[model samples]
Target: MKVEGIAAIVTGGASGLGLATAQALAGAGAKVALVDLNEQGAKAAAEPLGGIGIGCDVSDAASAEAAVARAAEAHGPARILINCAGVATPGRIVGKNGPLDLSVYSRVIAINLIGTFNMMRLVAAAAQSLDPLDGGERGVIVSTASVAAYEGQVGQAAYASSKAGIVGLTLPAAREFAPVGIRVCAIAPGIFETPMLLGLPQDVQDSLGRSVPFPSRLGKPEEYADLVMSIIRNPMLNGETIRLDGAIRMQPR
Candidate 1:
C-alpha cells in the first residue's frame, strides 16, 4: 500500500540496501523501525527520519522476537516487513587448502537464510492479526535475494546456497500467506553498489559494473528500494523473484 502512516520494519537498516529502503519508507511517511546488529549505528541512521532503531541478531529467535515485539509496542504491528539482513562471505566447497570450513558455510546459511525466516514468521504473524486493508491486503514482505542464487561464480558456494534458499522460499510463503491477505516476494539483485562491494578497489568495482549488458554500471541501493515499493504497491506481484540485474548472467570465475 500507500505506506503513509503504516508501520514498517527493515532489517539491516544501518547501511547499504537496508538503510536505503528504510530511508525510502520513512520519506513516504511510514512509521519506520530500523533493525540491525549495530544498535548505535541503526539509531544514528534512523534519527533524522524520526524513526526508532532496534538491536537484533536476525539469526537468533529470542533476539528477533524481542526486536519485533519492541517495534510493535512502539508503532503497532508492522504491515511492511523488508528482509535485508544478509552476509556474502565468499568461499569454495573444495579449496586449495582443503575442504571449506563447515563453520564458514554454516554461518552463511544461519544468518542469510534462517535469519530471514525468523524475522518473516514474526512479522507475518503480527500482520495476519491486523484487519485487512483495501483489496484484502494485510501486509507485504519483500526479501533480498541475490543473482548468485541463479548464477553463482566459482567462489560463492555458501553464499549462493543461502540466496537460493530464499528464492525457493518465496513461492511457498506467498501461497501459504494468501489466505491471510499477505503477499510475499523477493528481489534477486546483481552487482549492486552495496557497502561490501564498494569496499573493493575502484578499478575492481568499475570492472564489475561493466559486466552488465546495458546501463553498464552498478545497481544503486535506491533502485532496489524502488522495486520494493513497486512490489508493495502492485498486489498482483506475488510468489515471484524479480531480478534487478541488468541482464547479467554471471560466468564461472
Candidate 2:
C-alpha cells in the first residue's frame, strides 16, 4: 500500500526504532499514530509529525482496543501497522539464584510476543474491511524480531523465545491474511543503536559495535526504518522475516 495519505500506527513510537519508523511514515505523508507506554513522550514525539499519540498496553485487550479506536477516530483505521513495542529484560532460565522468576519470563512473553499479536489482529481486522488498494492490497504489517531468536546468547532465554514467536508467526499470519489482501512480514535486527543500548558506556558500546563483521558499528534506527519502507512498497514481499543485522551471527556469551 502507498504510504502517502494512508493511516499508520507504530507501537513503541516514543523512541528507538518505532520512533524512527513513525518519522519515516510521517515524512512520506502518512497519517501516523504513535502508541507507547510513555504517554507524555509519545504525545511529544507525535506532535511535530502532525500525528496523534496514544498510551496503550499492547498486551492488554481493552487498552489496545481503546487505543486503536482512538487512532481510527483521529486518522481512520491504520492500514500500516508496525510492531516495535517490546521489553528486553535479560535473564537466564536457570540463574545463580536458582531458576529465574516466573514473573520475569511471563512478562517478557506477554509484552513482546502477545503484544505484537494483539496489535496485528486489531489492525488487520480494520484493514480487511477497507476496499483493496492498488494491486489489491488492503494493508501491511511489519513486526520487529531479533537475531537472538536464532542465536540467543546466555541470559536471553525469555527475550529469545519471545522473538522466536515472532519469527514463527510470520508465515502463518501471512497465509491467514492472504485472502484479505493484507501482507505480514518481520525484521530480525541484530545489535542496534537503540536508546537502551545507548545508555551503556561509550567504550562498551564501541566494543559491541566492533563485534559486527562489516560496518563494525551498531545499526541505526533510521536504517531499520528504511527496510520497513521498502517492505511496505514491495507487494511481492510477504510471509518472511528479513534480518537487518550487519551479517553478524551472535555467539553464546
Candidate 3:
C-alpha cells in the first residue's frame, strides 16, 4: 500500500523503533497516529512529526479497540499498521535460584506476543472494511520480532519465546488477510541502539555490538524504519519474517 495520503498507526511510538517509524511514515506523507503507554511522551514525540498521540496498552482488548477507533476518527481508517509495541524481560525458566518467577514470563508474553496479535486483529478488522488500494492492497502490517527468536541466549527464555511467537504468527495472519488485500510481515531485529539497549551498562552494550558479524555497532533506529518503509512500499512481500540483523547470529551468552 502507498504511504502517501494514507492513515497509519504505530504502536509504542513514544520512543525507540516505533518513534523512528512514525517519523518515517509521516515524512512519506502518511497521517500517523502514535500509540504508547506513555501519553505525555507520545504527545511530545508526535508534536513535531505532524501526527496524533494516543495512550494505549496494546495488551488490553478494550484499550486497543478504543485507540484504533480514535485513530480512525482522526485520520479515517488506517491503511498502515505497525506493531512495535513490546517488552523484553530476560529470565531463565529454571535458573540457579531455583525456578524462575512465572509472572515474569507471563508479562513478557502478554506484552510482546499477545499485544502484537491484539493490534493485528484490530487493524486487520479495520482494513477489511476499507476498499483495496493499488494492486488490490488495502493495507500492510509490519511487526517487530527479535533475533533472539532464532538464537536465544542464556537468561532469554521469556524474551525469546515471546519473539518466536511473533514469528510464528506471520504466515497464518498473511493467509487470512490475503483476500482482504492486507499483508502481514515481521522483522526480527538484532541489537539496536534503542532505549532498551541503552539501559544496559556500557561494557555490556559494547560486547553486544561486537557480537555482530559486520558493522560491529548497534543498529540505528532509522535503519529499522527504512526496512519498514520498504516493506510497505513493496506489495510482493508477505507472510515472511525478515531479519534486520547485521549478519549477526547471536551466540549463547
Candidate 4:
C-alpha cells in the first residue's frame, strides 16, 4: 500500500530497528506513531519525525489498547504496524545458579511473543473496519524475529522460544488476515549493531561480526527498514519470515 499520508504504528520505535522503520515510514509520508516504554525517548524520537510518541507496554493488554487509541486519536487508525519491541536476555535452563528463573523466561515471552500478538490483534481490529486500498489491501504488519529462533545456541532457551513463537504466528496471522486485506510477515535478523550489542566490548563485537559468512559485519538498522518498505510495497510478500542474516548460521558456543 502507498505509505503517503497513511497512519502507522511502530512499537519500540525509540531505538534500534523500530526507530529506523519509523524514520523510513515517516520519510515516505506516513503519519507515524512511536510507541515505546521510554516516554522521553519516544517523544524525542518522534519530534524530529513530526510524529507523535506514546509510552506503551506492548505486553500489557490495557497499555497496548490505550496506545492504539491514542494513535488513532492523533493519526487515525493505522494502516501499518511494526512490532519491534523485544528482549534478548539469554540464559540456560540450568545455569550456574541452577535452573533459570521462571520469571526470566516468562518476561521474554510476554514482551517478544505475547506483545507481538497483542499489538497485531489491536491494529488488525482497526484495519478490519477500514476501506480497502488498491488491490483490496487495507494494512500491512511487519514483525521482528531472530536467527536464534531457528538455530538457538546453548544459552538462548527463552529468547529462542519466544522468537520461534513469532515465526509460528506469522503464517496463521497472514491466513486469518488475508480476507480483510491485511498482510502479516516477519524478518528474522542476524546479529545487528543494535544498542544492546554495541554495549559489549569492541573486540567482542568485532568477533561477532566476523562470524557472519560474507560481508562479514553486523547488519545496519537501515537495512532492516529497507526490507520493511519493500514488503509494504510488494503485496505478495505475506505469511513468510525472511531472514536478513548475512548467510551466517550461528554455531553453538
State TM-scores per candidate. Answer: 0.99, 0.99, 0.98, 0.99
Ranking by TM-score: 2, 4, 1, 3
Q: Give lDDT tens digits, candidate 2, residues 1-253.
A: 6799999999999999999999999999999999999999999999999999999999999999999999999999899999999999998889899999999999999999999999999999999999999899999999999999999999999999999999999999999999999999999999999999999999999999999998899999999999999999999999999999999999999
What lDDT tens digits, residue by residue, belong to model 4 across residues 1-253? 8999999999999999999999999999999999999989999999999999999999999999999999999999999999999999989999898999999999999999999999999999999999999999999999999999999999999999999999999999999999999999999999998989999999999999999997799899999999999999999999999999999998887
How does candidate 1 fare on TM-score?
A: 0.99
Backbone clashes for every candidate come to: 0, 0, 0, 0
Q: Model 4 segments beyond 4 Å from truth?
A: none
Which 10 consecutive positions of candidate 3 have the poorest summed lDDT?
Answer: 87-96
Which tens-of-lDDT digit does each residue in 170-215 have in candidate 3?
9999999999899999999999999989999999999888888889
Candidate 3 overall lDDT versus native: 0.94
> What tens-digit string does per-residue lDDT give for candidate 1 at 6-117?
9999999999999999999999999999999999999999999999999999999999999999999999999999999999998778989999999999999999999999
Evaluated at residue 30, the lDDT of candidate 1 is 97
Go through the candidates in order and give each one's C-alpha lDDT.
0.95, 0.97, 0.94, 0.96
